[model samples]
Target chain A: MSNKVHRRRFLSQTAAVAAVWTAAAKTPCRALAANDSWGDLTGRLVYDGAAPERERLVVDKDVDCCGKFDIRDESLMVGADGGLMNVYVYLRSKVRAIPPELQKTVEKQVLLDNRDCIFIPHCMKIWNSRQEFYIKNSDPVAQNVAFSPDLDQPANIVIPVDTDATWKFNRPQRKPVPIACNYHPWESAYIFPVDHPYVAITGEDGTFTIRGLPLGELEFQFWHERTDFLETRDWPRGRLTVAIRAGLNDLGTIKLPPVLFAKK
Target chain B: MVFFSAALVVSGCGQSESPGFRINLDGYDPAKVSQAQREAIGEAMEEFFGTPDVPRVPQELGLDAERIAVAAGPVEGRADGAQHGVYRQHCAVCHGISGDGAGALATTVDPYPRDFRLGVFKYTTTRAGAKPLRSDLRRILLRGIPSTGMPSYAQLTDRELAALVEYVVYLSIRGETERYLVQRVIDEGEYLPLGADVKEEVFDEAAVWAAESWAAPEQNPEDTVVVPPPRPEYTPPQRAASIERGKQLYASKNSQCVQCHGPKGDGDGENDLLYDDWNKPKIGVTPEETARLARLYRLPAQKLRARNFREGAFRGGGNPEDLYLRVYAGIKGTPMPAAGPQAGAGGVLTPEEIWDVVNYVLSLSGRY
Candidate 1:
């Protein structure tokens, strides 16, 4: 074939493929619309019985101790027994019935201010479809804003003095993005972006409450940034599964296991 | 032809014999140039000199022109001349036309430009009560400060430097004079009369005026100044109660301390993840990410957590009042939130709550 004719044919074939992909992508949203009822999924994150764990492990060895390393009074552990906090518990499968009023409230823009060289809320959760958020720097100094997502493209933005900036993520991902300010080396924050709005950050007492859950029996997934990932079949590191019902339900205590050490 | 030749010979002999020299001169007379061309040339000359007026002594114009005379001398004059141009081009943008350093730029530069009006320069070699020497100003001009937008004018010549120094001093004198006049006006409501021959007697008249002013109907001593009463010290029980209340509020649901700061009060909160504004991994987090996390949450590092109370560096403060102050005042340049009601210009917490928060934080250090 002549070069011009070949180019024309290639262009036509590429356009046809793109049209087919766009049509296929819209099908999932339509399917999700049919089952739009909200459901409750409750479970406790527990550490499986295993070998003794190391407490307050210093993964980064370069930090010099101003004094002797002390772990006894440290608040590393959460719950009454000091377990990990911020263990996200949510349904593994998709369930769609969200109330119209609840949806509106959920859609409100979440504000994260970088004041005095620290993120106001250390941990935040937003629905997957939520695209934009306000990040402000109230500090007199400049701060670097970096986000590392497990599945999507990461972004690094520089927040100038006394200025506010915004970041938007179009795709949905289940993992939390670790954030840190480069100018203020010690400043850090976390952002959990997911398709569902069933996530909650654990409070100071190492407790999290997710209210307004719909009535149903559902399997939930628990994930913490500090602990290892857990699967449905194998409830690893700090994972759990439970059946949630209508009304208020408290998932018993969740314990975070200590870090595993290999014998030399 | 015979007579003409004879005459030429006679003239030549006369010129040679008399020892007179004569030369032919031929060229354009610049004086006859067109008026437009002359004006254009004059403008070009002004542009070259960087100023319209020829340099002159300040004393000739009834100004304290000592500095100007000194600046025009060979050693300092050249430097001052170069600096004068720089001052006009850059410093005058803010320092003002008078060199009082109260230029238009003063309104924009934070901590405002130095008011040379006082002739008191900070960041100088001179000690307190001493005036900065010429070299001190020169050094500042050469090396610009970091973190500020001031740029160094190291390219100026020595003459320019000297001229600038003199001009600055001239501005200072004028500014001080202006201030003195204003002060005199404020004190007496007008310029006080000074008799040509009066000395000690002038003070007697002034004292009388002062007494009359003090007793005047419009004057009230209390209106000039007001002082607040001192705060009473808290009793032991009061202190204990405040600390207890503070601790309760800290662990409450609203504060949410445990999430990032671990339960034991260490900095290892469960959400201690190293992320950036974009939710990406921060650059080079391999070495000190965890320590950074602890610092962010205001948690004492593991090593510091076990230290004796005396050995630990108390960042917020040791005593309840000190802690309260920290919570109330919020560290000026840190992320530690001000727990006090009036921490920032418009803080959210109430004064009582700020005290409670301070008491609670101090309790964490085992100070109760």
Candidate 2:
């Protein structure tokens, strides 16, 4: 009887695997070329008004260790030129073909470190589900990382001082998942894990670049920690539909109003 | 109590319509899942796993249909004197027909009966965020949770016990799958009357993932199982010294045991306001919002208390090894973080240090 059950299970599992492959094959694919159709997306997010003063985080615990670090509010960071920091932009639609160079990033490990009781690289992008997400604690004080993803399995493990830990997501998440430290409530970070390689996070200059995307119309999602979804008048639910052309496709200086970042 | 129990059984059996598992909308925005969407979810669940009276065990889940058959259905004796409806006969009064834990007597208990829909078992041999082993469930059945209304089924035959264990797993998988389908429907915005595409893409994957989590402990014991190192025998003076060391580590920033467990282990931790993963969602942005959400979710949100070692009636087990595992893996869904090394990952405390802390905790409980 058990044998019969096993055989039936094996058959069903095999069918499921076949179905996944067929589904994968159905995704939109464009003609592959080294330099022909491949293009880069460049965009900048600027604050419409004067940059709000960054709030100073209260170092309640481990004052001797955490208080020394110049830790300001990381939820929103606008530079001198009004360039916003830590805005995530990623492809929503499925695309099969990818440039060879960008494909290599799937194997690379993305690092998120803890220094002076603060999560370094407050915002990060995990290019592909296959890539390992590594976390390190450079501080002398012990820190625990609570990684809770919406779709994937959640993990809340401790990262001892000077030691490191690694996590891997089983599937892509619809939105960036918050990585928080329960011990130190203020220590927080966000990780955007997607299956596709077309993902980027804005730097201090408020600019982001996705090296090689298929030259065609694709829907992309924009997200920020403060604002749940980077919704705009033009982009509903932060869904930006753009046509990727050959060479650099620069979306010239998109201005975001200060009202968007106002506390709800 | 006897009359109440009898009344419950009569009420349960007297129903004209068959009892079905409720579609868990707990912690979900009531507006998000429309009436039509709810109907779709109900239909999909029914299609995959039949009514509680007659279960359709998915082959991929590796559940024994014979075992499930022995456990499910209305209680009765056959001509041969063999028993059926083992679960309904013994457990349904408390565990409920669907194992939702909202039984007739659920509210009467201090700590409400555990809603297994979340798939978070508090006591388990497996590590944090992992499913309990079959053995772990069997152990609970035999010994039972000490302070809770859950009574030991020690008098039952091994076969009957085995059947109950398998049934629990089945119910858990079914419940978890229901949650997965709800998420898929909301996230993907699938139209009503979910099609073959959903069955293939969403339901199958959720079932397989859940089944695998249950199987992982047995399949890969090295990674999932927590094995405590041998406790070093201590003389009178040496034991005192070890306890002193543990006391320091407990207060140290490395463990931060004082923050939640309190400096005196009196359960009056500074951070008194704590909720487990299960109850956290029920809490809204404000008190008024929480009160409003209480209407949506039937059960009221309850705060989780960090264990007071001084009054030690450990839920998992009171043995030194159990304490060692607690400090090692931490309790799942609660604030207790894993201090000892996890599988393939570094941790704050070493095995020896964890044992020391365990010793300190034991001493606080006046066990030493």
lDDT of 2 by residue, A56-119 (tens): 8766666678878777788889988989989988888788687776675465798989888899
**DockQ in order:** 0.01, 0.24
lDDT of 1 by residue, A19-70 (tens): 1101111122212123434333333444434423434423221122211333
User: B266-321, model 1: which lDDT tens digit per residue?
Assistant: 55544354231111212233456544444322112222121122232343235455
Instruction: Report the CAPRI category for model 1.
Output: incorrect
Model 2 chain B: weakest 10-residue lDDT segment is B185-194
lDDT, candidates in the order shown: 0.42, 0.77
- Candidate 2's C-alpha runs over 4 A off are A1-34, A46-60, A63-85, A105-107, A128-130, A150-152, A226-237, A253-264, B1-12, B77-83, B88-98, B104-110, B190-193, B283-296
